[model samples]
Target: MGLDRAASIADLRLKAKRRIPRFAFDLVDGGAEAEVNLRRNEEAFEEVLLTPRYMVDVSRIDTGTEVFGESFAAPFGMAPIGMLNAFWPDADLTLARLCKRQNVPYVASSAASTTLEALAEAADGNGWFQLYVSSDDTVTEGLIARAEAAGYEVMMVTADVPAAGKRDRDIRNQLSVPFRFTPEVVLQCALNPRWALTSLKHGTPNVANYADLLQSATSYADVQKTLITPSFDWESLRRLRDRWKGKLLVKGILHPQDALRCAEMGCDGVVVSNHGGRQVAFGPPTIEALPAIAEALGGRIPILLDSGVRRGADFVRAKARGADFVLAGRALAYGVGAGGRAGAERAMEILLLELQRALGQLGVPRFADVTRSALSDMPASQD
Candidate 1:
């Protein structure tokens, strides 16, 4: 379908599914085992309803907001997805460039296909690097120092994923980094000619950040052993912040006390996320934790949120409830997967327009005016 016909995030997702391979889509779309938390995150968005005010002149709406000591064109930004190139060619750079043009934050994952230097340069040193801490303090310290040298202004240490989630889809597809294809797997790739050709042309994908430190594993079992370990903890976060001289952010916080602890621990911000519901099956929805976390932070630190954010209305819902800004995950990746840099641009464009439209209808003159008064209590059953 044409871009004109793609009026909503759902439409863009549909387009993305058709263009990208099934394995790639599953990586972007799948969550933890059972996916109960994933479904709950989406459901939380629906539970909150906006009660708009009428007869208020809001012809000129300001969607702009400042977060992390930077002014953004809008209150929402792109959330990082690991191994994006596995979905589409050059996905990391494509999205980084798009975010740079749009003047919004773009997070780079440790598991991403591109390096921090490339993303920082492409994004004009405005990008944040999301680090997945290792058990070894020496390796973790070195990575943080490298990120600082790369000119990353924000250092986000992902506290979740102490152990990798049980993803059934990846197991079934046998989609490891250095892929080993059985007869059935080869046939599956052959059915999707574009994915097969790209894999052949580019050579198999490797984890960019870990490429130098951790070579491609000989088998899937080996990959699992290295990636999924129970060694990550609060000490890792302490070491990461101490080593990196930049804005420290803690992602994957879903508890009010945890958010408070982050601020006490000298974190500048905390992203209210459950790793897009990709890590925990029965965890609290990100939206459900926002108000409490925001209250806990009490303006000491910014609380950014992500998960199930697909529409401009979703951004409104998030901001009204307590989130300073919203982060889009699958929406942006799907956009990049569907097209390229253009698709990423289209994704941002759609959200900006939607935010403007929602602001106009809500009679809110500025994004700052969006308050708890604008939102009713979400159903308890929602979470």
Candidate 2:
């Protein structure tokens, strides 16, 4: 389907699946073992029903909202996605540019294919940086300095991934960084000529932010081992907050206690997430976790929701459930994979239009006007 015909994020996902190789698509599309949380994330959103009040001034709708003292055209922004180039070459850059043009925020990942500086330049300094703590304090300090130098105002430290999740799809497909051209991979690449040609022209994707550290790492295992710090904890967050002067947010927070602790530790915000269900299979969906965390924090820090936010109603549901803002991952990833920059823009356009329509339908003039009163009872879980 053409970009114009792509009415939803799901449509973009279908297009992306056809455009990219199976292994590459699966890396972006699949969640952790059993993917129960993955499906639950979307299912939970459906449980939230909006109650529209009629006879109100629904003519003017504003999707705009302020986050971390920065104004965004919409209440949603691009979530940080690692190895973006695995789905589409230069996908990180594409998303940065899209967010800049759309007047929204883009969080560049520590494991992005493009460097933080490059993404910052692409987003015209509207980019936020997501950091994965390193085993080496020096490396972590260097990354913080780079982000500060690049002019990123907000820094998000991912707290969940103490260990990597077992991604069965990736293992089955034998997907790896610096992709090994095994017979299966080679055949798959050959089958997807467009992606293959683009990838070939752009060269292999590497963790651009960690290029210096990855130099000595000859294999994917070496790269993984050198970068991930299994000992990441609250102390690590305190150290990061002390060293980094920018706004600090803790990502991958599901428990309300963790969110409360982030507030106690002086975090600027907390992203209610489960690493997009990539880190845990049975954890509660981020949507299901947001209200409790938001209540626990009690507006002490801004709460951003990620995972399973696919449509405009989903965005409204998040806001009504107490999220200050929502973030999209696979939505834009699928867009870039489908048709590069234009596809990315298309994805943003669909979400914005849907958001406006949802706000109007719910009799909410702006995203801030959405509240728990606008929602029906939460749906009971099937299982």
Best by lDDT: 2
Deviation from native of the Cα of residue 156 in model 2, angstroms: 0.4
* Model 2 C-alpha lDDT versus the unseen true structure: 0.88
Please give the TM-score that candidate 1 achieves against the real structure.
0.93
Instruction: Report, for every candidate in turn, its global Cα lDDT versus the true structure.
Output: 0.80, 0.88
Model 1 lDDT tens row, 1-383: 87666787778788878766677778888888878888899989889898777898988989889987799888877787878888887888888888888888889887788877888888885588888776555656676777888888887877777778877777777776566667876666777777668667876666777686667467655654544346766665676667677889888898999889889878899999998889879889999889888887888988899988888888999988889987888888877766667777777788889889888888897998898777755443442
The regions of model 2 sitting more than 4 angstroms off are: 378-383
TM-scores of the candidates are: 0.93, 0.96
Tens-place lDDT digits, model 2, residues 1-383: 79999989999999999888898899989999888888899988888788786777988898889988889899888999988898999899999998998899999999898999999999996799999888888888888888988898899998888888878898899876556789988888899999999999998888898887787776767776656788998888888888888899999999999999989999999999888788889899998898889899888889999998889888899988899988999888888988999999888888888888888887888788887878766442311
lDDT of 1 at 294: 85
- Give per-residue lDDT, candidate 2, residue 299: 88
